[model samples]
Target: MNLDPPISSSEVTLERLDPLSAAAARPVTTGAALLALVLPPLTLLSRGHEVTQPLWLIVSYAALGGAAWLLLDRSRSTRPVWTAPSAQVFQVLLMVMLVTAAAATAGANDLVRDDWAPLVVGVLLVASTPYRPAREILFWTIVHTLLCAALGVIQAPSAITDVPALTLAVTGSFSIAVMGFAAAAYARSLTSSTQLWHDRAWQSAAAAALEHRSGVARSVQQRRVSLLNREVVPYLQRVVNADGIGDDDREEARRLARSIRTLLVSDVEKTWAQLMLDDLVGRHPRLNITAVADDPDDLGRRAVLERRTLLRALAAISVERLSATGLALRLSTPEGRLAVRWEVATPRPLPDAHRELRSMLELIRGLTLRSSVHELPGRLVIEFEYGY
Candidate 1:
């Protein structure tokens, strides 16, 4: 009876999704890296002859930070994630750079006040927040803070300072705390919100999928009962009430069994697309996305099964970020290439939808085309040809 609606599916999470990934934050990393390159040289330039071992300090601190920035940024793009081991190594390198800057100073400048290493290292920590967890960032921040304080204390004893070494310690590394803790807090809050959304959305989607499958089974069973009631069940009852079964009854039973068999076989022969639609319909409990396959020219073996993951990613992002009312995708080959038309419906216009999708668009550049964002009130229609 419920032949009108089919189903669809989507999957997206903030951590790995292109929106919030380390790769997407390359500009931030690059800016921090640039600052590292500039700050130490500026310290030497400003202090003129007062700063000690200019070549040594700038080379060690600025060079290390710049190299770390390059390495971390590249890793994010090349891999699924910047591994925790790699991040740990990178943070260790940062602390070593700070210690080197302090040693190279030789107490000519206040190791705490005049050194560029502490401030740049703090910026680097903020940049690393995208790649590393909050706990790890905070832990490393504490480590860096202590290291700065120790350097300041060692320098304080030999020099003329009105402030106590402990007080100097707090002043010297306080910026690191402010910057690193702030970045860690941001990462923590974002992670929690994303995790909560991911959990709730998946839970609701799973429940919807289960309900849809159960409904389909019940529908099939109801149809079977309807068929059996017409002649097969009544005929069996009469035969039981009568003395012996006749040739006519035997023929009728065989015909009924054949009809049921044919029906089941036909049901089994449906295309992959139809089956996918059936399973995916009502899967998103949020909007209850109902799929209706308009594949009059049906040739379905996933219609480019390699692109299923892409579709899933796009769908997930659309729902999570765009507040999508519904999602529709069409996969077809035109001019010997796969043509995809993806449409997301929202209750209101998302002016920055394209901007939000910048990273994902890059991932599938071949499938992006300029279209009606301003003109379309409640829909985003993306039509493109994808060769890869």
Candidate 2:
């Protein structure tokens, strides 16, 4: 439950906690994107006569198209979690389209009450709530809201209006403020719900572990059996089914036996992370997995269980994916921060492997303090630094 790099006043990502909410938002996002594509241009067509500068309107709709494309693009579809960089980009693009749309009639007309910019921005923000933290959404909302008012003021100089510029500004930004606040509130609600669910789940698990220790032991044994079934049992069954043992069978048998040996024998002093890597080494013994631990515990402050989930993901991509390659894992505690350094030697790196690696890491980037990926000659290096 003690996750590092926590979201604003929340346990972690809304996407991680309430994936159903995140998945549900996508259809709404697509709808909003289509609105962006359809609504503004139609509004411009009706009010096209009052335009002082036609070029600005053209630029505005072009930016609108960009924002729509940003939403529709499936480049990041493979990633399991929401990514901040892309979401922030979408916000920026949206603002650009809105501001330019405002600029089309900057000094000649009253700010259009039916401005699609602010409305679409708000709707999109709501759609993004499940993917982004409330604090981040609110920050961008406030900034854009101010810009909305500023647009009103800029247009008020020559445009005939019954109300004061301040009133106009406030009135102009009313929809944005309302919708932005709504999105932020929804985001907070999602975070709270996800946190409560996690706390309850963890408490139930703890109570069960304490009250029924034997059940927990049996569950662990079942998992161990499942692990053997994936590799060892398959090779054994193949040997029994085949006419005789070939060189390939013998090599596979040796590998599976090494995995069993590695699982059965464990150093009491080693951390769970170390044991995990040992298991990986057993599975892929051809990879000369050299591991060195500076301090016994990976994170001296957090519980071993707290760090396992993230580290397991780290190990999967960094160590488990490669085969017959020399890998080195270095775990050190520098300045009370957990720093993990891993390098897997792949003599011939696959095409676009770096992109695939980066996309994979994006799923866990929210959990770690910082991460860096370097594709060196004959090796792929990844480093993760965790905070308390």
Would you estimate the TM-scores of all the predictions?
A: 0.55, 0.59
TM-score for candidate 2? 0.59
lDDT of 1 by residue, 1-388 (tens): 1111211111111233233455566777777777866877787776555546766666576557655665555434323344456667777778778777776766665445656778877888787665566777778889988888887887776544567888777777888878888977877766667667755866776677568668877866777888889777888899899899899888988998899898788567754455555444435555656444444445444343334445656767777677676666666656545555777777654657766665665455422222122225567776554432
Cα error, candidate 1, residue 239 (Å): 21
Cα lDDT over the full model 1: 0.63
Q: For model 2, state the Cα shift of residue 41 in Å.
A: 1.4
Collision pairs in model 1 = 7-277, 7-280, 7-281, 8-280, 8-281
- What does the lDDT read for residue 172 in candidate 1? 78
lDDT score at residue 94, model 2, on the 0-100 scale: 77
